[model samples]
Target: MKKQLGDSNILRNWIKGFEYCEIGFNKPPNSLVYLACTSTGRVSNLRIQNLDFYAPFPNAICSLTELNSLEIYNWTGLHGQIPSCISKLVNLRSLVITKTSISGSLPSFSKNTNLIGITLSNNHLSGTIPPSLSTLPNLHLLDLSSNYLCGEIPKGGNMGQFNAANFANNTCLCGNPLPTCFNSAHTSAPAPAPVSTTMFDSAPVPAPVSITIFESTPAPEMAPDSNSEFLSPRDLDTEILLLQMKKQLGDPGFLGNWVIDAICGFTELEYLEIYHLPGLHGLIPSCISKLVNLQILLITNTSLSGSVPGFSNNTNLNVIFLRNNHLNGTIPPSLSTLPPNLSSLDLSSNYLCGEIPQGGNMWKFNAANFANNACLCGNPLPPCFNLAPAPSP
Candidate 1:
């Protein structure tokens, strides 16, 4: 009296019965294609890529409650919102759906505590990114780039470690690892208290009349305090640096109490390291190149853009790690001429292009140092085709 296929076989049957698209596998025992099941016959992983099919998100896939990883890529015809029922897959860890026509706001995955990575880039997704995403404790890799997401980026948790490229091409999105939000009302902190005009007004004066009429009076100008001390050149420079950072980085909480003297104390700084600071956006401060005594310059995992600063002045520099940033433009040719003291360099994961300069310490590093760039070529990387000799007659 028992059914032919028991409850444990339900996920397997769903996979076989699925006909919305032609599923193919790499070296299939055809029956087990496109999916991997747990010993209990529950589907645990599903990956479908490059299939030409026109269909909405396959909601039936959500029924595989044990599913831990779901990846669908380059399905140009795949459309519709990622079904909310996906949250039902409590074991879901990694969800990647790229190069599709999927459109919708990212759904909340509050129940999926084990979730680690979520990449939904290169799609038609629109709407503000949910702030709750920042609260995911185990979440690390998040790439929502090339979509239409907008609004301020959330601040806490591991969000500060993600690369700027992860959020690139979303024109409307603003805040850390991207540009600062100009709209004051949307900022995370409360707006500054309005200035009191009454404090600047002169005391009310009675006019010479039967009725007590008030007369307009001019406020007296205040004199500068004689006890105020003049700031030295070093102190002034520190203040300027602090203000520049504040203007560019949008005043993160850790920097709220930073005073000019705190930075002035580091006048002889030899190794300056700035990492895991997501709010650290904007160009590499040209003044950094002026640190003649600096032996190491490490600024990684931020949204720093523009060309790499000229480090010719830092003759003592031995290590430079500017990886995982939004830096564009060609590597400074001068870097190849740096003194032999320069032994380590890492400019990977940036938008840098053009040929890798030869000579000097450039020969010391390998391909890994210059990997993941926009159009980098030469020695350490695949040679630039443009540099190839003309095909003879």
Candidate 2:
């Protein structure tokens, strides 16, 4: 066939034989761009970057039976939903569409088995992440960052690492991996069984090596009140093994103005996470520091207010969650005194201020946890470099 055609026409046919194509514009196109013959072309890869074109020839484009990779980036003038025909590209692997105004949930790729990399960032797309996308085995690098997406990040399959920053900017995402919704009743789903760690040293250690610990001793053997359950010895021991306990508190008859003598009793409590106790309010009593074994404390979504108590005595306390309340005054620098093992401490959507505590676990969190609190300052805060150093020494 090449012998029958002129050299010039043959060259044009030869250029079209490649399995890959990239098209872009340095300036506005003077005429419509059409590659009708390229439809039957063998191109397995197509990349269109920084180009100005609206609604490219659709149904025929997806007909590229051997197409493998497709990328469309930084073409702001191109507006509309991604062509639904994209799912027909049976051999497509990597699909990237960034900095475009494509507004839609990612179309399902049920038949596109070879797909691996998918990114649709910086778009106006809205709606939940399709649960179907989680089923892809070879797919990796799913970046939906900087979109107007909402709803919980669906938990399933091998979704690669996700974080608040990746799901930030979007006001409606929540649950584990991301922080729980600000004003919701979703219970924390228990975490998966942890991977076991091993100690490598074989040498015998000294006799008094380290102190062992239990979560809590059983409550004094009181007869079962009509409101409580009678725990058998085994059940009681199991209760003692829980590092964190969440007990529902019902209101005891006490009207508003009476001097509420004390907060609820928790003698052996280690990590107390109190939620939805509507009757509990007023000052967080200073006596809470009595629970020496407490390592984490979260008092969220309540009406409790007043100054955060000084918990300087609880040296072992690592994490503290006091979000979505009306608390006031500066966050206690005493928080910085917690043991170095502290990882996450959320104080978001509150009314606290003053520079963040220095030289401790506070460095692990980002500033959004301090959002809605206008006066807070320091590293996590934006314009953070403008913050002054902690008072010298």
- lDDT values, one for every candidate: 0.62, 0.52
Off by over 4 Å in 1: 1-33, 184-393
Model 1 lDDT tens row, 237-349 = 76676666444445544445432213223445655666655545677767666567665567777877888888878776655879988888888889989874464578999
RMSD of 1: 19.7
Q: Which regions of candidate 2 are displaced past 4 Å?
A: 1-41, 53-59, 181-393
Across 251-285, the per-residue lDDT of candidate 2 in tens digits comes to 22222111112222444554555544444567677
User: Candidate 1: global Cα-lDDT?
Assistant: 0.62
lDDT for residue 41 in candidate 2, whole number 0-100 = 50
Task: Give the Cα-based TM-score of candidate 2 against the true structure.
Answer: 0.38
Model 1 is weakest, by summed lDDT over 10 consecutive residues, at 193-202
